[model samples]
Target: MGINKERSAWEKVNMARAQERPSAKQYIDRIFDNFMEFHGDRNFGDDPAIIGGIAQLDGRSVTVIAQQKGENTKDNIFRNFGCPHPEGYRKALRLMLQAEKFGRPVICFVDTQGAYCGIGAEERGQGEAIARNLVTMMNLKTPIISVVIGQGGSGGALALAVADEVWMLENSVYSILSPEGFASILWKDASRAQEAADIMKLTAEDLLSLKVIDRVIMEPNGGAHKNIDAMATILKDRFISTLEKLCSLEEDKLLMKRYEKFRKIGYYKE
Candidate 1:
């Protein structure tokens, strides 16, 4: 509530990085039922960073895709610190296209510092993969919703975030680049990350005020990890209600609205 409001952008970034902050997997486990996780990109190897599958939201079929982070060091290494590769994005797109064919809603949970930037990832067409998703998801027929549950950075996060409506957790951040990266590039000093975070306006409250996000799912006093059940409940309620409205729209209207939603972003002049 007011806790999120009182925090500076840098404070929100720290909260987002907290080891206790609930991961996408935790939310999926709590909010959905009968989740059947699928594997592989069918082009390259499977990625543990991106998880996708068919699931039931309430009693309705839906596609759940999320960028997963580990709670500890060992798991983080296994999960690539939540930085997905080209194959991960490809795998997610495969599931999303399937969801469209089946007329199922798609729910995306975005939580990554950014996409993997290693040489191997680039050689695998990471930019192309992310670009493909952005274009395809923009026109996807099914109702789509994306939630920034933690760090939503760069094109990696945007690939899954072209939805009818995008939301964010109270302490999560959405930005073109991580604050440290932004500082390093702009000020030649990564230590100015705190100032860069403020300038980037990556915090949920900032994004909401800028109309970059439709809603901010308020966290409990201690934060989301401290009360994951409560956070899941809040998120589930929103998913159900929003999907109901989105699903009721005619196919053409749904696509049109989704198009307009994004087209209207960045309309302001300095």
Candidate 2:
């Protein structure tokens, strides 16, 4: 199982914000009902890294897209450790478009280290795929919400994060670059990853303070994995409330609000 042993003391104290899990798929499957999974990018083979389907929450239908990582070596190979290729983002874009056309509220769960950086993915237009998704999500006319349930790094997270509202589980991390990646580039030492993580201010609380995230979803005392049912219930309630609020707004207003939310992300005065 993937473990987080290098976190600082403060991070350990906040570990109750969300539970460390062997995998998020289990929690999602247990919480959602009547889920019908979709497959394939249509132009290319399906990417297991991105999973999307229609499901019911409290008997209300919604579309969900989640980045799925694996628990074991075999599953990791299968899911690509939640690192998606170009086709995976394409598939996500297709689902988002479908949700928009049908006027369904879309919910996305982000849990990726980043988009796959393999030569094959680049050759297949990885940059273009992520860029296209970013634009499409920005202009999407439906009520869309994204939750960063775990690791939300680089372009992979951004692809699904351009929503009407973005939430992050208290323990989850979201950053433009992974700590190790940043450390390698800035310090020429991957060993400085912990320092990079501290400096990135990627925690939910930090992002909330910066207004980069709409809210910090509380997790169980010990973590989400410690009490999956409680976490799921809280998530469901929050999602319902947020969706109702978003749905009440006019389409133009909703779009403007989303645009303004993003535009104001880096606002600061010296």
Candidate 3:
């Protein structure tokens, strides 16, 4: 899609949350082959919101992990609106560790509003689950690539996002919290979400400028949903190129680079 330079951050946020936007399931179906879905955390029930499996990408085995959001009401309810519980994070961690064991790269598609804050999820240790993933991912021996395919909100998104290379779709967004939440916390009015988005620097381009993401994948003129075939092709190419580059690095170097990458993320003027 032709880059719309005039689009504001708030506009990009809306686009990222568009109901017609492509979900993680769609990306898996289009970009990979021989996907064998593995279910459950082996401690609790499987979480539909976090889908993890082994898939073949360009004839190479890779672990595919993503947060799945439903397009319709029925599906959304079934998937908990893509808000994962503690079990979902645990499931993702299991797959990542398994990928490392087998010497396969881990590819993550991040799209979530954050971990579920329900009492049950809290009782199950949601914070601990995400925290574990963050620390473990930092030290993983295999290459990790994370793509923000849609709305990436808070720690739920970050749990899957710690990677050697983090990419975001041109119209996607990644932020510490949702615009509505930011508005509520800052202005005591959720209606100022548009205003909050303006100043939040959460858009893909904005994040890239801030060095928050390594790259940006351009979508179709309107959006990825507008041209799935073209979008998928570009995404596939980008993934392959990135994977090839990361694969060339030694495991220790990869881990060190990943650690250093995140260590330099924030601004501190001397």
Candidate 4:
């Protein structure tokens, strides 16, 4: 409960990346039932980093997509530390379009360092994959709700984050880039990541104040890692309520509003 005081953006970033914090897999397990995972990008092999499939949330059918982070060193290597590759984005898009065909709402949980930047990834069209998703999701017929459950960074996260409603966990951080990356690029010193975090305004509270996110889901004291069950419960309720609201809107109206929601972002007046 000591988090009674406001936390700095850097502190929030650290908390979001804490080893004990709940990851997308844990949340999905608790919040959804009977998840059937689908693999492969159809064009390439499967990627463990970005997982997508069909699931039931509170008796309603939905398509769930999430970036999975590992809990241990071995698992991290297997999941690529949740940095998705081009194939991962392609797989997600395939599943999302499938969901749209069946009128199923899409739920995406974002927790990634960014798209994989390895030479292999670029060779496979990482940027093109993400850009394609951004374009397709803008007009998807069904509703979408993106939740930043942890460290949401760069275009990798944005590729799956276009939605009618975007939400962030209290301690999660979403930004154009990770603090270390920003520090290295701007100051030529990655060790000054703390300073970059402060300047980035990446915390959930900051984004909420800036109107970049629709809502901030409260995490248990000390962060979501402290109480996985409670955190999942809150997220489940929010998902149900939001899906219910979105289900009532006509397809055209939903798409129009989603367009407006994004178009209005970053607009400011002095």
Candidate 5:
């Protein structure tokens, strides 16, 4: 009968407004010039959850994939708050493949709670779709870079994150599973989610220390939402620098580094 603090925190952070928050799309529009959007997976219906397009970052051509959360009730239903269904990931895969075919570098903005787990999504093979994206991304020929702008949970996040260099905002989270889900499975009580979150090591700082992420992009003092323009500028600079470094590498060397990067993710010795 009392208030649930964990649920409150989860909702407060997760349900924060797309308009109020400094979103990835806003940054892309303001910072990147000559942007052009592409649509649909071609095999299925178009998904508003994932937005992919071509953009010029400091005058260099690049492909951008962003997980878009909606601004209002109707748009929320459309974008699904950045939670991609199977088709959405497929759409992303199509764009990534396009970028590779054209030898264009890819930039991904990740901001998803997880892949859509609805009955419809399952029927459409959401898990298979995510797995396929991971496999294809691992072997992608063109340079790939990812930025975790907000919630990057489970396979939804992983699909876009198989990049040569990964960056995470200071306050963003990346995890294999949500804390509530983890607590439900591990402790048999969802009320212990806070404890699970502490154990999961989902924070950007923790991942950076573990080498799960290549770098941490600092947000404004209050948060990214407070100073959107400043945050966008910082990200723009980092993206330019990272892409330049990746572009300098030969395909074979870049692929080798990417392979090694993922290989070291869970490596430990006692």
Candidate 6:
């Protein structure tokens, strides 16, 4: 979507969560040549909320990791509505480490409301798992790129987003928390989520201006669901161009720039 100042942030939020919007599986199919999905975290089990694998992007092998949500109630339950657990984060990190080992570029897609907050998830060390991903990705040797294709909420999204470059779809939102959560915690009124959205600066346009994201991938006039092919085409081009630039750098330089990218993400004036 083109930058539309008139579109309220909350409306964009709704669009990002639309069921008809093509999910990570859809994007992976269209953008990559052959995808071989890997399973399990080695310790606990496999997680459907996250899908990771080896794929050929423009004839170059790359690791593809993405958070996935289902289109219907049954599938959503199976996927935990794309809210991953500790195992999901571990799976992502494992695939990332594999990428580093094979000298392959890592591409991540973030689209989660947050990690699963259920008692069972906490019992399995969800926080620790997410934290480990952050530490590992920060120092990983391979070039990495992450795109927020939909709801990138909380630490769950951040777990997969510590990359050399982070992009966001025009209608997507990447925030520390949902506006409802912010309003509920701050004002004790979840109904004031619209108000919270106005101040959160979660939109791709807002994030790019704030230096929170590297670029904004334009969607259709309404959203990605309006024209999935067009959206994926633009996204594929951006990925290829960026990957070429990143893969050209020396390994040490690649790591340094990724480090500096996060260090420079602040809202203050120079």
Q: Estimate each model's TM-score.
A: 0.96, 0.90, 0.96, 0.96, 0.90, 0.96
Model 3: lDDT of residue 129: 97
1-270 per-residue lDDT for model 5 (tens digits): 212223333433353323566667788897788888888888878888999899889889899998888766788788987799999999999999999999899999998889889999999899999999999999999999999888888889999999999988877788988888999999899998877877787777778888999888877766678888889999989988888988988898788888888998442212
Tens digit per residue, CA lDDT, model 1, 83-102: 99999999999999999999
Q: Write the per-residue lDDT of candidate 2 for residues 1-270, one digit (tens) a residue.
A: 222335552363234223246255765676678889999899888999999988887777888888888767788899998899999999999999998888888889998889999999999999999999999998899888898888888888899999888988867888898777888999999888778878888887778878888888877765777788888888888888888878888898888878877888432222
Q: What do the candidate models score in CA lDDT, each in turn?
A: 0.92, 0.81, 0.91, 0.91, 0.83, 0.93
Which is better, 4 or 6, measured by lDDT?
Answer: 6
Candidate 4 C-alpha lDDT tens digits along 206-257: 8888888889999887788989999999999999999998999888888888
Clashing pairs in 4: none
List clashing residue pairs in candidate 6. 1-219
User: Residue 226 CA error for candidate 3 (Å)?
Assistant: 0.5
lDDT (C-alpha) at residue 84 in model 1: 98
Candidate 2: lDDT of 52? 93
Pick the winner on lDDT between candidates 2 and 4: 4
Count of clashing pairs, candidate 5: 0
User: Residue 201, candidate 6: how far off, in angstroms?
Assistant: 0.8
Q: Which portions of model 3 show Cα errors greater than 4 Å? A: 1-3, 265-270
| Number of backbone collisions per candidate | 0, 3, 2, 0, 0, 1
